[model samples]
Target chain A: MNGVRTIFGREIASYFTSLFAYLIAAAVLLITGILFINNIGRSQDQVAPNPAAIPDFFAFALIFFAPLLTMRLLAEERREGTLELLLTSPTSDSSIVIGKFAGAWAYYTIILAITFVYQVILLNISQGQTDLAHALCAYIGIWLYGGACLAVGMVFSAATDNQIVAAFLASAALFLLWIGDRVGEVIPNINVARFIRELTLQSHYASSFAVGLLRAEDIVFFAGIIAVMLFITIRLVESNRWR
Target chain B: MIEVKDLSKRYGDRLAVNAISFKAQPGEIVGLLGPNGAGKTTTMRMLTGFMPPTSGSAAIGGFDVVEDSFEARSRVGYLPERVPLYPDMTTEGYVTFWAKLRGVRQPAQAARAVLERLHLDDRSKTLVRNLSKGMRQRLGLAQALVHNPPVIILDEPTIGIDPQQVIEVRETIAALRQSHTVLISTHILSEAEQICDRVIIINQGKIVAQGKPGDLRKKLNAANLESVFLQMVNKDKRA
Candidate 1:
């Protein structure tokens, strides 16, 4: 739809024009680059070397970085008062939410793609002994993990006008999803604890795809969270008129 | 054409708009005049379908603003109290984006014509953040007019603009009187007196007076609408 394209275009344009995108990109890339050079660079193993380590490192890093990237998706517009212009237009609420999600997802994908150079360099020097499929699988997991984190961050962004509050709330939310299984283990009902564990970020993505096993259900879980978060977000914005 | 009957908005217990009712037909420019905190913005928001009325109904071209919000909104253009804009976007980009969001066919052409009509052609490529307050106000007006909607609700369109820009904007609005029904809110009594065909004066969320500006002035036995407004509110306080 033209509405989707228009909103998504503006949202993506802002990511390039605003400093938040650059900050997140710089921070994530800097930390990842440092890890690539320090921990993975000094390895020569054919099995458990840099290829194996970089994916795990980036996956963990994205769990922390994606929230920072998505913290201002909608919250900053409310804070700056631009949400009024968007809301008063003839566009539907779902279009706005989907547009925003697509834009943020595209930006994070770009950032993730650039980090592929690290994999290339490690491959080039190692005579192509690296398991590309394994790395690809972890990359997919990271993308899905980032997507889920972005959805959670977007929900927090919609709940408030303060960017700092949104950021912290998103961070706190992702942290809970990251550790839900660990926290659930101490409970009385073991089945309930295992179900709660299955709901965590690491349990869902890393346990399966960390070793490059691509399960349809794991992919569905991340996509499902994104869909649900956006649904709730659209409903929240629509309710503002009534409230 | 617009009609609002017993429209009210209450935020938790404090009433913002209290059973206000009015109507304005096609080819009319109605001024919503009120002091600060008089629910002028709230009323405009309800009419534009940005906010729902607590109790009562608003119909724009016979479409209910609440029940038929999307259909009602499709025919209306709203400029909120503060011009909320993406500062990073150029004037042209901002207008085109708004037009497309409002479902304008070929938004690029609409944006170009609207900018030219608003006398913003020279600054079309300039970022909105770099624009002056007057230019930003014009940009806001340009976005509101981009879709060529039937009804235009402008909340304090002239607020904080320089005198020269105010005259330019007033002239622009007066020119728009040929096609679209305009609802303008302003605290500036003289500007409203010059531009509005009918004026609704609200005080404390209730309509205290309504008539042509000149008629209201003559009825209150005052020199201008400001003096008449003061007398009406003063009389209400004493009663």
Candidate 2:
């Protein structure tokens, strides 16, 4: 929709203009780069290096970076009272939510794209022995996983007017999702543990694209999370009119 | 044309707007006069489709705000009390963004035209954050008028601006009377008396009186517009 595109354009422009976007990108890249160097540079002599190490580190870093990137998406608008203008416009609530979510996702994808240099570095370090197929799957998997995290952050951002509160809530939610499988490990019942593990983001990533094994169910899992989070965000933003 | 019928808003147990109804004829400037918290903003919000009414209805250009929200909203432009703006954007970019959102055919041209009308063309490239409060207020008006909508709702458009800016904004609103159906809310009774063709006085979320400023003054037997407004609001409080 035209409204969506307009909002998306404004959002992306604002993100680039603000210091928040650059700060998050710098931090994510710095930490991820360090982790990449530490892992691949230090583990060269191993018989079979774990190809999943860099992607795993990237995913873990996104749990924090995604929230930082998205915390201001809606919360800042609400605080500045721009949400009133946006809502009062002809634009639909879903369009606003989707535009904002898509804007953040697109920015996150750019950050992820920059991290591909780490992949190239890995390829060179492995002396052409790096599993390019596995690396490709990891890239796809991490991108989707990052999208899901950004959507989750958007939901929290829509829930509150305070950026700090939005950031804290989104980070807490992402942290829980990241560690859900470990929590599942300590559960007493086999069925409950399996269900919790299946719900965990790590489980979905590790079993499928994290290891070059792409499954329809895993892709669906990430898509489903994105859809549900964005849906909830739309509902929350819509309720602002009534409240 | 803008029409509202028994529009009400409730926040928990408190009613922000209590079945208030009125209409602004095509190309007429009507002022909503109310004290702070007297529900002028809430009513405007409902009419603009920013907020749904707890009951009743509002329509703009024959489009119902509740049932035909997008259409109704497209026909109306609202300037909120706080002059909402994206501080990072230039004046031109901000107005253009709103114009595009409102579905203008040529957003850039519309934005420039509105800025020119408001005498803001010279500062179009200035970031909103760096502008004076008065300039920001004018930018707010620029965005509201960029789409050339038939109905305009402005809530306290000149609240915090300087006296000169207030006059400029008032003049701008007066200029709009020939082309747009405008509803302006303000607690400043003199401002309403000077500009509004018809003024609606609300107290405690209900319309206390509404008519031409002079007719209301004559009926209330008050010496001036301010006295009439005070007498009405105070009389309601006494009751």
Best by TM-score: 2
Query: What digit string (tens of lDDT, one per residue) describes model 1 on residues A29-116?
Result: 8877888877554573433554546557755666567767677778878876677767767777788888998898889889888888
In Å, residue A77's CA in model 1 sits off its true spot by 1.4
User: What DockQ do the predictions score, one after another?
Assistant: 0.68, 0.86
TM-score of chain B of 1: 0.98
* lDDT top scorer: 2
lDDT of each: 0.85, 0.89
* Clash pairs (backbone) in predicted model 2: none
What is the lDDT for B234 in model 1?
Answer: 75
How well does candidate 2 score on lDDT at residue A24? 79
Clashes of each: 0, 0
